[model samples]
Target chain A: MLEVRDLHAYYGKSHILQGVDLDVGEGEIVSLLGRNGVGRSTTLKAIIGEVPPEGSISFKGEEIAGRKSHVIARKGLGYVPENRDIFPTLTLRQNLILGQKSARAQGRWSIEDAFELFPNLRERADISAGVLSGGEQQMLTICRTMMGDPDLVMIDEPTEGLAPQIVERVGRLIEEIAARGVAILLVEQKLTIALHISARIYVMGHGRITFEGTPEDLRGNEQIRKEWLEV
Target chain B: MEVFVFSLFNGVLYGMLLFLLASGLTLIFSMMGVLNFAHASFFMLGAYFAYQISQPLGFWPALIAAPILVGVLGAAVERYALRPVHRFGHVAELLFTFGLAFVIEEVVQMIWGKVPVPYDVPPSLNVTAFAWQGLDYSVYRLFMLLISVGIFVALFFGLTRTRIGLIIRASLTHPHMVASLGHDVPKVFMWTFGVGCALAGVAGVIGGNVLGTEPGMAIQLGPIVFVVIVVGGLGSLGGALIASLLIGVLNNMAISYDFSLYPIFSLLGVEREAEGILADLVSLTTGAIAPLVPYLLLVLMLILRPRGLFGTRDV
Candidate 1:
């Protein structure tokens, strides 16, 4: 549903993303894997119009490169930043309400559905989001993006700082979201989960995709992982 | 006792008016994180608009129309003037607003002249509302009190009980998150500035006659409102109310009481009307300098409660 070709982005004078090319089809889970500071996050940001992409970004056949972030969001492109940007001062309920395109617009996800998926959110729906645990905040950031009901979601590091159990839950949640016909572009640090879940994996190094293959193909090629991914 | 009561009532009336002005300042500052140095200029615009509108349509219509006109002007300024300078960082934006205030004052003087415009209270509400303690309070004062109270109530309800208000409150904290949710955030900021200036405009409509509408009107009221915001806390509406009322009452009391430090000296048998720096310091007590009270509160709040009474961020 999304097509990106020869994407390049910059931070001031420094080139952060250099000629990156990738795509994700309908309901397909694609993983972008790399070591820290390899432009994986910048690739997603460039696609989502945060970094001002230099090349081409066609999302469902629309030229969206250099568009404003909100305009991209309106075009059914949801972005969850790596930092887990939650409104700390706002209550969890208000945050969710803010996530929707319109309060009255009917979508597949409801507030009740979110509450059911994570009972912790339901219990503290009325309190400030700042007080939530890191894992709960991660859940909130993911679920909050789902409230927008984007056709394609670019999530950056969803499992960062999360416990193993919570990380498993995040993996399941991604699977559930993909099953519901939503395409996901996941930027993950952990290799095992990305390999297990992603239909296709793109190993990034030095601002470009060094390797792109199926999970089995990636497993067979240890040279690519040792050079681009392993610490 | 009667003097004390006089200051008390007048303080309340003035305090409410200050709240009317400061609440808008609070909203704009808290949401946009821009100080909006031009806020009081909007208040001045409201008064001038009321003066111009009331000339043809009369006082009541001007009261309603002036604020709306000023609000639109505020929105346009946000879109054109303020938004353009945002790229240069907050200091440039602040300087832009500061320069805008100067331009507004100069334009106001050119249009209305350097002299104060004859923006008087309506003839119908000129009569006395009530008399107590040998004082006859004008009905206009009561109207001002009632109108300010109404604004406070409406603003409170609108912000707390509506979806738009919820969005505004959320925007105050997480602007990017709201935008990611598909809101045109710049539009939200423009409207926020508009709403804030509208509230100030409304304050100017009622406060014009009492405070006087002149070129220096903004200069006089602007710093006080900033003081109100700072002392209240940078982002807390509740804190603004408390600070406004507190500043208002202290200002009046300070003006009314000629309670010099001479009393302590006299108690110590140091004598009256003595010469030198010690006597000069003692002679100059809380009298006729109401402006000092806000600055005092500001300093104390800065030193004691830097985050303000309810502010989460230290500004």
Candidate 2:
């Protein structure tokens, strides 16, 4: 479980995260939906300590605000950046190994499971990550983070530039992860995937949560979708 | 033919020494993106430490002790000095390292009195190792070559096969990504800097006697090693090795051959323009511009292939 309350973050005095408050219960799939630059990604980054956070970010029962990104990561929080920051020079196997908390941590996932989940990665295990296609890279980033066996994973736009087919695969993967009892705090743009998979949806506007309810509650609310989400 | 053969052999030896210095530099530059101007200063410290410590404990122990001392000092400098400047960006880090080099030189002068110390080869290695074309090569130079080769082999294995090596190699390309994977990246960086400095220190310990351990030692060797790394490529260790040997052999050959371009011009039946700059350019000898060879190669390499021989990215 993760809880964020009144989290304010800044990039050189330009206030990005004004006061974001959200939560993801254990084994729950929660989606935060917003248009670009409404601080959706920033919220994830602030939670991961990629940017400094004000107020409190509690993981399970312990506070983890303002810790280093690596510290936050070892404390069982996984972040998949929007850029798909795979080590372009390393092989896929090397990248996955680095995702493990220690050199020999057998945690919960294996490289074989990753290959089974997405066979393309196993085929290109020896090649450098730079040559991976956009979709393969997305799969690698998600699987690599999962290798760390985080209790909760925060994914920032896992399907932004992926093909529709690959996007569908990603949606299925998110469900599979949730089914395995791993909570997901997904920052997504596709309203369809969010509506399908998210137990609850929070619509954000201008660095603050504007709506928090069940997916059915959000689907019925046309006014919130028009004002805050749809272009 | 013998002159050519001897020069070629000497060049190989010199090149191996350059490789010892350049390999560490290229790795440091690759991983930290810091062009450490003080690297050769650590080399200088190694020489000085060897000279001082050898006086009490002898050359054998000094060979082992000096590098460790330099490594510890390098680790401290990285943690205390370089880490602070890192936040100010690469240029600030560069200036800090540059200034640090100056401080080190002054410190060396203050302690050693600006004089070349008497750092000599041990009595055991003083004899000739073997005869080359009836000319005996000192065992000391041969030992230096052996030490360099050993370091090269050890380094190659350590980087390719070890887990820490994976972290180091990964950190070079994607530092933040490595950190997010749960590594203390600053600690990795500090160890890298320390190890890189230790390599340079090893070079100095063995090279001090032959090269002379003076305050100006870094100045004499620094530019040439830079030429080695740049010509090889910014981040490619393999390229560094090739470039080092190429420069070393070419420098040796150039110094041996007193060649002027004026004869070629006359052979081609080209009329020399009297009192023109063309006459000045043609008469230049290979020996005269031998020191400029590496720079010429650098410029040519940059113009033709900016990424270098094995480089994946631009410097």
Candidate 3:
């Protein structure tokens, strides 16, 4: 389980997250839903130690607020940044090998398991990452993230730029990952995909969590969606 | 003809020495994106260390020991100095290195005095290796060639065939991603920097005897090595080799050629002793070309092929 309690995060002097609190239980798929620039990504970044947060962060009961991002990663957290940020010049194989640095075979994900999930990656293993199509890049990014065999994976916009079909495939993949008993913190813009895959959803607006409920509660309540999530 | 052969041999020997210096520089530049101004100072330290150590131990041991000492010193600098300044940005890193170079030079002067250490060829390799086309090639020069070739081969294999090598290659293009993958990227940077400085040290050990281990050698040789890296392109090792050899051969041919030996003059019935207008032309060409060859090559390379002849990426 991961817990963020009254987090206050900033980018320079500009305060981004003001008293934000959220949680994801063991093996649960949680989605942070919001319109653009709501500090959803910043919340994920703060939890993973990419950005400094002036609040308590407890991951499985260990405080990790001001630790380095890499150190936090070694403690069984995997972060996929918003941009995919794959090494452009390196081959897919090299990028995948890098993910194995924190890999644990018994924890669920393996190199062979990833390749089975994303078959296109196996075919294009030797090719440069930049040349992959947007959808393929998304698959590779997800596969690369899984290579770390993280206890909790933070996926930031995995389906952002992909086509509708690719987005659906990624939604299914997220569901599959959750079914395998691995926790995921997904930051997603597409409400349909977010609502379809996540068990519990939190709507964020302007750096604060506006609403949190079960999937049925969120779907039935139109007021909170219009106030915070609607364009 | 004999002078041509001698100069040609000297050029190759000097070229290999330049390669050793430039390889370290280019690797550090590619990985860190900082032009280490103190690189030549490390080379100078290598010379001084070898000069001092060879007196107590033998020349062979001095060669082995000096580079290790320089590598340790380089690691210490990376840990204590470079890491602290790395957060400030690239320009600050460059300035730090420049200051480091100045400090290293002053330190060397304090420890070794402002005198050129007398570094001599080892007695075991002091004799002539061969006489070819009426010219003598010292065994020491041949020894330098052998060592340089061996190093190039080893470096090539190490960078291409090892796990750490793959990580370094990955680091060259994407340093942050390499760290994010859970590998200790700082340790990689430190080791690469240390190895780079150690290479400069090895080059200094062999070159000291040939070029003379003067206190001012680093200042004198630094620009030429920079010229080699620039002409060789920024990230390509192949470019370094071609540029080193090209500059070497050109420098040799420029100095050794006497234009009075031109067959056209003999055919035209121009007297060899008449001191014609061509004689002054030849004298000017000879006077201006030796020190300027590498610079001229650098300028031409920058203008025509900015990425260098074999570079895969832009400068």
Which residue ranges in model 1 land beyond 4 Å of their true spot?
B1-5, B263-273
Task: Summing lDDT over every window of 10 consecutive residues in candidate 2 chain A, give the lowest-scoring window.
Answer: A99-108
How accurately is candidate 3 docked according to DockQ? 0.40
lDDT of 1 by residue, A77-140 (tens): 9989888888886789977887888878767788898999988889999998999988888889
For candidate 3, the TM-score is 0.89
Worst 10 residues of 1 chain B by lDDT: B281-290
| CAPRI quality level assigned to candidate 1 from its DockQ score | medium
What's each prediction's TM-score?
Answer: 0.96, 0.94, 0.89
By lDDT, the better pick of 1 and 3 is 1
- Identify the candidate with maximal lDDT: 2
How does candidate 2 score on lDDT?
A: 0.88
Candidate 3 residues lying further than 4 Å off, grouped into runs, are A102-107, B1-12, B258-283, B305-315
**Candidate 2 lDDT over residue span A125-212, tens digit each:** 9998889989888889998999999999999999998899999998888888888889999999999999999999999999899999
lDDT of each: 0.88, 0.88, 0.82
- Ranking, DockQ, top scorer first: 2, 1, 3
RMSD of 3: 4.1
Poorest lDDT segment (10 consecutive residues) of candidate 3 chain B: B280-289
Pitting candidate 1 against candidate 3, the one with the higher TM-score is: 1
